[model samples]
Target: MKTEKEKMLAGEAYLATDPQLTADRRQAKKACQLINQGDYDDEAGRNAQLAALINFQGSFYVEPPLYVDYGYNILVGDNFYANHGLTILDGARVVMGKNVFIAPNVVISTAGHPLDKVRRAAGEEFVKPITLGDDVWLGAHVTLCPGVTIGNNVVVGAGSVVVHDLPDNSVCVGTPARPVKSLA
Candidate 1:
């Protein structure tokens, strides 16, 4: 069986452009067109378009004009809601649990470019899967980094940068995301 790292690298290779690979940008472009049109009213149409755009499982809703990079890797759960200006750079898989609520200006990124200049220049990138558990609420301007797993019933405050895993039923805030208190 392929390790997660191997799988991630393979997926990234599929997304990234190289002489050997035909990059899949169609899904992302299609999603952007549908969202930018601002004409989706019926629940079925909106959901169908989004599902086509992304690898969505279960039911979820996204407010229009939402920007998602490589939408083919995102998996949204039932009753998920993301407000305006939500950008998900889902070069890797982004899994969100049921009843999750995300405020405006929230950025969740799965692809992490290399810090080293040479490695970055060589077209090397690291992707880590981001997972948000059930009933999680993220406030406005929250930025979630790669490989972060937020536990169930977690609430992340505005302007927080989550760089590490957060335990269940915790309220996390501030840069680097320290646990403020337990919600349980």
Candidate 2:
């Protein structure tokens, strides 16, 4: 039998209130709090906290006030940068490639609750991985939904809600995030 954490990571429906999951979330919350409370100019302190929280590669910069459910489920490649108010509900893996830039108030979420009222009331949830390819840029207030895979060199306009996979070198905008133009 799979544990709740195992099921959650595998994208299977699991109870969010399971003790192990709750403990992991608590740890992540504490790390986030420390990072947020640390001085903005104290890059070393902030990066140290983030290193303890996630699997980061090379160098990255994230402005304070970041939130995550399970920080261990997230991985970022070289030269990633995000402005303030970034939130990631990383129940499943969130992988970002090199040179990803995110504007303020962006949300990248992998956690999703069941649509059935009974399941929702029971606190059952599932998750899907989110991927961002190299050189991707997300404008301010962009929301990347579960299972979204944005391709290389793509530019998502401000306030866009990406609900589907985006092709490489595309410029996407608006709600539901249709490809407005191809950059190829």
Candidate 3:
């Protein structure tokens, strides 16, 4: 039998309340809380809090008040930067390439409940990986839905919701984010 965590990584339905998964989430949340509430002047202390859950690449900076379902499922390349109020529902893998910039209040979700109320009530949920290529920038209040693979050199405008894949060298905007201009 596959463990809940395994199922989650495999893009299968799983119960979030499973003992092991619950424990993992709790640990991640604790780390997040400590990082958020810790002294702003104590940079080393804050880094220590995220040492276990978040892995740092070459150079990266994420402002406080970050939230994640499972921090282990998120991986970022070099030079990744995120502003305050960032949330990642990383039930599945979330990979951000190098030189990625995310503005405030951005949401990257890989976990979602079933559309069927019965399944939802049963506590069944699914996850899909989200990928952001290098040189991408997500504006404030942008939301990236599950299973999206955004290409490199792409810019997403504020308050946009991305539901599909975006090609490289493009500027996307609006609710269902469409390419408004090509940077190619």
Every model's TM-score: 0.85, 0.98, 0.97
Span of ten consecutive residues with least summed lDDT in model 3: 49-58
* lDDT, each prediction: 0.80, 0.95, 0.91
Candidate 3: deviation at residue 127, Å? 0.2
Summarize candidate 3's per-residue lDDT along 29-141 as a digit string, tens digits.
98899889989888777766765677656677778999988799888899988899999999998998999999999999998899999999999999999999999999999
lDDT of 1 by residue, 79-105 (tens): 888887888887678999999999999
lDDT by residue for model 2 (1-184), tens: 9999999988899999999999999999999999999898989989999998989998999998999998999999999999999999999999999999999999998988888999999999989999999999999999999999999999999999999999999999999998999999
Regions of candidate 3 where Cα sits further than 4 Å from its true position:
none
Q: lDDT, candidate 3, residue 94?
A: 94
How high a TM-score does candidate 3 get? Answer: 0.97
Checking candidate 1 for backbone clashes, the offending pairs are none
**RMSD (Cα, Å) of model 2:** 0.7
Question: Number of clashes in every candidate structure?
Answer: 0, 0, 0
| Residue 111 C-alpha lDDT in model 2 | 85
